[model samples]
Target: MKNLRLERCGITQYDEIFYNLSYDELFRHETDAALPDSERGVVASSGAVAVDTGKFTGRSPKDKYVVNEETSRDKIWWGIGPVAPTTNNSDNQQISEETWYYLKDLCLKRLNGRKLYVVDGFCGTNEDSRMRIRLVTEIAWKAHFFKNMFIRPTAKELEGFVPDWTILDACKITCPEPQRHNLRTPVFVAFNMMERMTLIGGTWYGGEIKKGIFSVMNYFLPLKGMGSFHCSANMGRDGDTALFFGLSGTGKTTLSTDPKRLLIGDDEHGWDHDGIFNLEGGCYAKCIKLSPEKEPDIFKAIRRNALLENVVMDAKGVVDYSCDKKTENTRASYPIDHIERIVRPVSRGGHPSRIIFLTCDAYGVLPPVAKLTQDQAMYHFLSGYTAKVAGTELGITEPKATFSTCFGQAFLFLHPTRYANILGRKMEEHGSQAYLVNTGWIRGKYGEGERMDLASTRRIIDAILDGTLDEASFETMPIFNLQVPREIPGVDSGILNPRNVWKDKADYDKTCRKLAGMFMAHFNNFTDTEKGRALVAAGPQLDAEADAAYSSEA
Candidate 1:
């Protein structure tokens, strides 16, 4: 095998490189070879390799930065509003050309003399639109992770396959001179879109690598007239495709992995003139509390060659999926083919006939399921409404309302309105229906109300896909102006209106008005644009008299 050395880049002083090693080779290297103290190779009960990412188990979104170069400065979204001190503030600083070069040099230097592992793969599954990628990491497990996460090339396809983009993962390297580097922390995850290269250092979290490539796709795919989505998709027996959009904890993965439906892609995808294509070759699913009964496909997918991150296991290698002692962001990375029923070719699928926006509403004010008009769809799409449940992040004990534009704010490159407009146009052209489903609290607030039963949520989703809900009588909800169905097959009629389920109707009304106010307040961030204005008009309306009456009662 020809070792592709980075010495050609004029930075590597050493000549060692392991290029395109097979799964067995990587496993052997990680398990038998003398690895770093930070890297631990543990075998799970299913014979899969499991590793712990110390300190940083989840993504450090604030640390992610995009170089504001001349070619991409105007095209990139530099984030709006005030920067929060504790949040990932990638938009806060636009690194100078000199600084980017300096960081690249540092990353390459860190790789020198280290046993580098390189994995060559493709990003998009569509043969027509696929982009070749080469990832160089300091650890063998990361190489294995990337191999599973990205589309692998066959022997014939791998011959002379030049990468269109490259990622240098120097996870173990940390900058000792933070002041000289002008960094808030010793670690950094920076992307230079102009160079089509990403540099990651000072963190061991593998998600940074996965999402870094996604960020690149989010930027470049739009210029090609493709809509890049942070959503999951699957197709039915009748060739009907459905897209599920939501953030972490919002059932995007679980719902999309329907046993009856053929999985298209989970997490990220790109929609073009033809149809949708999977952006990845694998699934990186949240495995905390994962059980076979709840998600058999995902549960069974964790077999040999799968990589479990931060999952607690006993001395005998039996995994305890319920444990979140390490971190709530426990994950499992496995190849897409691991699942029994998946769309063959895994590249492309027909345009979706139904679009579902999944949200976890802690406030319990939103309806269980609501049919959205075109305008309302665009409005909700931009708002990206959801609640950040406790324990997902540090210091967040109670549910907090969050509005990430396009449902993947951390990975967005262009203005959110751009993606929203594309979606609206596509929905209109294809006559696709949109629905908002809240798989969260019911009757009262987070502490007072119980979660919507997963079985009920599944039934609602089934109805949406089979067109059963289309025949049900609809009623307009107050404050939010949502058109909710009066009845469904499996769900209780009393809970449909939300207010009926609450013992204190006045409290429910007050909560609804409060949520409506929150929506209007968050919408103010985009009111300057014409599309934003239209979306605002489509949102929930608050009544002044009702607000005063509710306030007086309080």
Candidate 2:
């Protein structure tokens, strides 16, 4: 076992200073890191202290312990080193070691009254070591909201913990009273708003998820549409411009901020009285194999305050996004401060010019993008779109499908219907256009990787930005298909049919039947259920007469 042997800080040094227990005894004998003082004891007393391997003397991190894959499976091993960490695939900014200690200092200072510590709680012994350390400091400050931040001690640990829903119901939340304590450091403020107040953290890796940070803790407020979901809505001017929703990889950031179009907000946004206003100060970009060439602007935005997650490291522990062995959300979460329009308190008001939903259809049969009629819009909205996370693909080989309404669930704090209603009402009020764009592979089956030309994708974006597609004559596609005018510039007219993604006509028909079966099955789960039906009823009709007019291979 890799143990912490206190050579300098002696036993009985400050025992029972606050909590009626021996500090030295606790530290020396406890498997748990450091214990917190009970109610009647000392308040948080620790300051920013650097993480060292031992009480004294410098030691080579690699020499202190060995990485034994064959043994020590249950032990946690923190990478002890002296140098400041460089930015990873997910982050472009490197936090200094001094700044790192400030993060611990914040925990020490805030723990006295806090009840939680939001953290990345995935299955990693390395991550757990850090989690334990966070607790040691959390109890010192006793900050009121740090509970549920670390690992659950027992099954019943959740017994009295406030349910996530309760926090959502608490309407007005401001920067905690004295405002956020100015540690003069930028430790990530790990808070969840998707469905409740959750412990959230953003650790830096290689612009990807690394240790213990959760990306899907959106708030749960049902203001409109349907059940709860993660949403990011912000209004720039009249709020009648656009709202982007998609999973991590889909080009929400890329498409929404079309170079020709002005950007309202980048990442987290709250839909308020005026419109959508971004709640964050930065964007968390995924950085697998990221290069200045592929996404120059995003690449350049990383600097100070960005936290990289789960990027493979080099011999020097520097991030290497080129490696795909790590988790899929190899993400870089930086404050929204980088984007110009990010609002304070993250609230805004405005109208939208259009409502655009994005999807990455790996199958590639879908158009680069297609505008929708009212009915068609609702149908596509409910169907949603998903592609497997880069490394998360199953060995089963077939690309798995995940359906989520209004794609950006990682930040939405309301039911899906709530967002849908606001969007629908606003679209009607301002005569906004609704469209769906597919940013995945094209001209090949899901795994073949014979991709759609990015040049064509650019052209499609150009058409959307310039309003060329708005005038195209879109016919209602028959048999559960959205009306796609036969020949649209920037997209191949021939591949509009679902059957195009498959090679043999027989295989095409089988997949279509299977997909249709899934649709029917999911649809059956709802009988007059919430706004889901309203969305369906309001969408394009599956015309019985049109079913026979066109071939499945049309």
Candidate 3:
């Protein structure tokens, strides 16, 4: 075997950096050498290695930034407005070139005289469109994490593979000059599109590393005439493919990993002229309350090579997937091959026949499932509506409504309407069908209403895939203009219409009107263009009486 070293890449500053260590080597170093005593490993019941992220569990969205430079300045979307920011930051502020170089120098300086780990990998599964990536980290576990999260190259492919993008993660290096760098805190995650490099410092959370790469793919894929998505995809026995779009806690991973279907990829994907391709080589599943019975594939994937993040464990090395003492975003990263029933090729699949937009509507106004018109589909695709439940993040004590355009507002590089336009064109050209499924509450608000049963949701999805739901009688929702089915197998006909299930008819009407108003308010951000106008016109409509009633109630 050939030796791995940074010298191969012409980096003379670091002489002791270990390049492209195997999984076994990474695991050994992680457990026995790289980590501190407090960050030591624990063996899970299934034999996987588990470790806590400490203090910062979930992603720090606020800390993420894109450097403002001439190379990609005009093409980039800047600042959050009536429309949500593409970066998902409240102040999508762009730092100066001096600030970016300063941070980069600081990160590189921190790695001096320190042992580093590097992993060479690919981002896109489509061989023709994939970008080579080099991940350099200060911790052994991060190298292991990248090894599991990214597509691994075979020995032949690794012989002379030069990276197109490089990510330098010096997680322990805090920026003391936060004020000068225009950072909110001592931590920073910044990406330079022109340079094709990502810098991470002051935080050891694993998600920063994953999402940093995702942001880069989001920027470049669209420019290449491909649509990058934050969704899970799968193909059926008959080669029928489906895509599930949702934010975290919306069951994108769980719903797409069907026992009957073959998993293509979870989390990130790209759609191009040929078909849909997995942007990642593995699954980073949320492990909160995980169970063998509920998700056997993901549960079993938690084995020797899987990397557990922020999960709570007992002194005896038994993992408590149900424990949230750390955070609700506990996660596990494993290669797609870990799942026994995944699709062959595992990187790319046929163009999707169906696209499902998932939302956990806390207001309980949307029906369980609704067929969308082409215009309505574009509208909802741009809206990307969902509710954030409590415990998913700090300071969120109840379900809060959120609108992330294209279902991934945080990682977008261009305006969301641009992505929506591409999706609309593709769906129209391919003659694909779209549906809206609410994996959320019904009949009442969050605290009062019962969550939509997982079994019922699954049955609904099965019906859609099998072409049964299309045969059912459909009724038009009053405000949203959504086509709601009157019946579905394994689901009560009453629950098909959210209003029918509500005990208080007046309350349901009021809640529905309020939600409609909220939708209108959010859509106002994109009403400047002709396409935007059409989309706004396709959304829910409020009558005079309902508007009056809602106003009086407010």
Q: How many steric clashes between backbone atoms does each model show?
A: 2, 101, 1
Question: Evaluated with TM-score, which candidate comes out highest?
Answer: 1
Q: What's each prediction's TM-score?
A: 0.94, 0.57, 0.93
Point out the worst 10-residue segment of candidate 1 by lDDT: 81-90
On a 0 to 100 scale, what is the lDDT of residue 471 in model 2? 79
- Give the candidates in order of lDDT, highest first: 1, 3, 2
**Local accuracy of candidate 3 as per-residue lDDT tens digits, 380-456:** 98888998666745765456679887888778778777788888888988877999999999878787798998999
* Runs of candidate 1 exceeding 4 Å displacement: 3-11, 80-93, 389-398, 545-554
Question: Highest lDDT: which candidate?
Answer: 1
Candidate 3: segments with Cα more than 4 A from true spot = 1-11, 33-35, 80-91, 388-399, 528-530, 543-554
lDDT of 1 by residue, 289-327 (tens): 999988898899999889999999999999999999999
Model 2 CA deviation exceeding 4 Å by range: 1-240, 315-318, 339-349, 389-395, 408-415, 496-506, 525-530, 537-546, 552-554
Q: Regarding lDDT, does 2 or 3 come out ahead?
A: 3
lDDT of 1: 0.84
By TM-score: ranked, best first = 1, 3, 2
